[model samples]
Target: MTRKLTPKEAAQRYLREREPDVARATLYNHRSLLKQWWQWCESQDIEYVNDIDGFDLAYFRLDRQMEVGEVTLYNQMTVLRVFTRWLQSRGLVANGLADGMVVAQPDDASRNTKIDSITAQQILSYLEKYEYPSLRHVVFAFLWHTGMRLGALRAIDLKDFHPKEHYVELHHRPETGTPLKNKEYSEREVNLALWCCSILDDYIEGRRHDVTDNYDRTPLFTTEQGRVSHSNVRDHINQITRPCDYTRECPHDREITNCEATTRLHAARCPSSIAPHDLRRSSVTYLLDEGHRKELVADRVDLSVRTMEEHYDKRSEAEKRKLRRDEFGMDG
Candidate 1:
């Protein structure tokens, strides 16, 4: 005999059935989306599992069309579809609510817009001129040089870095709280450049001096007290860029309108306008410029070759200009 189950019960069962390897954060995200779906159904006076038809799902998609972007709507639809399918499998619902639902495709133009990559010289100038807490500066330097994703960087422990070996082992096991972006076997060891090794050594030493308790088990990047949240890193980037003068002028001192000053201003202004993911793109670009093969670079950085080509293949305006000048044999 088939038994009736409420939306909440079905959601709980679905979550319990999810892959054990899924990260806690990912599970929490799915739960949050399900809660939103439940709230919508409750407000509409609909018996969520029984009353939500394909038409209701369609209406919800249309309602959220403008409020949410295409990618987000797609993910939400995916989550709801999974929930409805679970209900159907358990004989709780007659039909899956999302079986016939359609999600809008992402606009090609919007998806194709290139992300700006920070140059090595620009990053160096920012480090030299900008004043940040030593730990934060080191964190920025490591990310710019190493190409580690923001999540992986935040989740890294003290033992992740090997100064003598000059390599970082990205452990993607369940216990480490590191989520693999794709398949389970994607985790691998990545070699660090000498420059990144030196910066990491300094940062680790500085962190030792800064923290007094549980230093052995603490995160690599942290605030004065201990490990910092991702939000803290975002806020720090905003704070650093708030006073930047992006018109190629030095806001601190107008007379200093040289290459060094302009570069610093650009770096300072970038974080507010750009996402942290751009740092990874910049690092990939650097690797490519240094004669690294695409496949090797992708494997080292835990990214696919297609992803490297699609996102990190951007050439800066400065690089383009230099190329043009060299081709034309023009004197500057």
Candidate 2:
């Protein structure tokens, strides 16, 4: 008799089935949600993956809702519902089991999709003055100014820099390492502003540790052993943006002697600290606000016009109309 497949086994099969049609990033995200469910079931002593029902799924949904905000919960549930439907397709779960996992229908409300983008000027002014010559300062500057994805930044190499031209070449190298989100199509040379280039020059000459990752690729941003992982980059961005760093006052009012983020290596737990991707969104918006055409901004950011408007461009309707008026020669 064929052995019963575990949820872990099922998830892998589902991913393999979907990998051909979906983007690598999308596949990774789907696998992540399913992996969480598998781990949660294991924690609950669920020995048989095929045994979970809609009621169990509902409880899982509640647990997630309590742990995260509405936006996060909604995204997680949407992925969970997809996994449930996949299970149903395989005849491993009852029909319509995915319905129980649905918590709220996603709408066009701004809050439901993304948070407000923090402007480049706001973040850069703080990072430039307070955290200068630091990795956080460098990372923040690159993310905010380039409008590049975290993964693309993570993939940068030491040789990719052309200091004379104030630009760096981005390559998609999935076979060896450092895969760009859009693969080969994402490869291009991005020019930096004069000041930004100077900052990167100082960082390379002083701070960045010279090392090669396991793939034998020499990364521009390296820690002691090799290239810094994705989590490290995210942690650096999170810690530097803590309210205490910029304001000189701890918003949480915790004692300096007792706080977790007081040290250089630790990230702040401050609720307001935004992630690396938020910086990308902010870059797109800031450029648009400066009267840069939407198409130009989209091309510079390596995103399609529709994707930028639907996702990256965070301008309000009034703000958008104001931007268009300059081209139309209309009164403000």
Candidate 3:
């Protein structure tokens, strides 16, 4: 007889089966979102994964929407749908139930688009003019140029810097504490433009706080207490991306004095502020725009080709072909 899997068992199996194929961050998200669904199932007494109905999925989505922002809810729901389909494939859920679930996109979804290359450059120019040698300057410059993930950047230590070579080596050291999203697979050396290196060197000499991480590892980026936390990285990006911080103008027209985002804790609430991942996406798009080969870029950025094309690449068909030809010295 075929065994009926409980909701929790199905989620664990799904994540474990996908571990080899997906990034650790993506896998973690899959685990977190599906666990939420499984928890709901437990509370509702929907013991078996096979019994998850369209109504149940919809209800669970409602519960999630209440818990997160529209963009985040949409993302989590998207993941949940994939999990639901996986359960169906195992004969644990209703057929086509995942396809049957409809999660409406919020009207404000467009507001979440990643910063474009030009905008990123413009931000750099602004930072260079006013915030040179500051953490904002170094972080934005690195994120906009290097297409590496935030986790990889966060995991860097003072020892990883090669000033003469102008590169940073990313390593996977989960045993010592810094865990890259792709783990050992993400280990690589990323070259930095001289100007970028200059700013980073300046930050190291003048701005970086003298501190270490929980593992007693000296971090390239630090707080007074120690290595900057992940939330610190997020907040730092948010702090730098704020329109008021860079542009010195409030497009939102909110009273700057009264703006909650003016405070460090609320920095991410600013509509114009971007997440660190946006910078990574912008960097990938920028490299593609500059006629870099996708494969080469993928290798340098430690991303899969499919991930580069499907998520990071934003070029039009003609733009892509032109870049390809340009790289080969062939004119179309």
Which candidate comes out best when scored by lDDT? Answer: 3
lDDT of 3 by residue, 1-332 (tens): 55698999989999999988987678767887887788899999997877778888888887776555456667888898888788878777668888988777855643544787667877889888988877767777887788777778788999999988999999998787678977788898888889888888889999999887788899997778887666667777877787788777888889989987778867766777777887788788888788777899999888888988998887789887887787789965
lDDT tens digits by residue: candidate 1, 1-332:
66655566667777888758576656766887787777676667775465557777777777665444454567678877777776777666666444666755655443322223443345455654553225556666667667777666665667777889988776554454445555366567777888778767866665434442243455667676666655566444423332243223333454443423234323322223333465677677777765567898888778888977877767667875776677679999
Please identify which of the two predictions, 1 or 3, would achieve the higher TM-score against the true structure. Answer: 3
lDDT of each model, Cα atoms only? 0.61, 0.76, 0.81
Model 3, C-alpha of 195: deviation from truth (Å): 1.1
lDDT of 1 at 242: 26
Better of 2 and 3 by lDDT: 3
**TM-scores for all candidates?**
0.59, 0.81, 0.70
Worst ten in a row by lDDT for model 1: 264-273
TM-score of 3: 0.70
Instruction: Return the candidate ranking by TM-score, descending.
Output: 2, 3, 1
Q: Candidate 2's error at 306, in angstroms?
A: 3.2
